[model samples]
Target: MRMYEIVLDGELTSDLPATAGPVGRRQEGGSTVLSVPAAGRDALEEVLGLLESLGIGITAMSEVEAPA
Candidate 1:
């Protein structure tokens, strides 16, 4: 699995859909940061699709080391 940090353009007003995987969510400035774990590209894409469907705009995304 891989960990990813997705930074959204605005604060999330509600909880993320369950399919987003086991996520760590928090706000940093005006952005909502989501720490998601995916098994592969397909899993990551699924989360991205869910975010798009929710009308959330992603400002940035990058792979990250798993939290201890």
Candidate 2:
């Protein structure tokens, strides 16, 4: 599994995706930061598609290092 930080151009409500993985969200300036962990490539793609369907602009996306 890998952790990802999906930074969006706008703030999102908690109920964005009911089937999404455990998400941690917060607003940073004018953007919303979503911390999502994916089990594999399929899962990651699903998240990306969902974001696209919602028409959310992705400001940034990067893998997060696992905690030691």
Best by lDDT: 1
The residue pairs that clash in candidate 1, if any, are none
TM-score of 1: 0.79
Q: Residue 37 of model 2: what lDDT?
A: 75
Instruction: Show the colliding residue pairs in model 2.
Output: none
Q: Can you write out model 1's per-residue Cα lDDT over 1-68, one digit (the tens) per residue?
A: 46888999899867776765677789999888987775566657877898898788999999988777
The clash tally of candidate 2 reads 0
Per-residue lDDT value at 66 in model 1: 77
Residue-level lDDT of model 2, residues 15-41, one tens digit each, is 467576566678999789887775555
Q: Backbone collision count in every prediction?
A: 0, 0
> Which 10 successive residues of model 1 have the least lDDT summed?
35-44
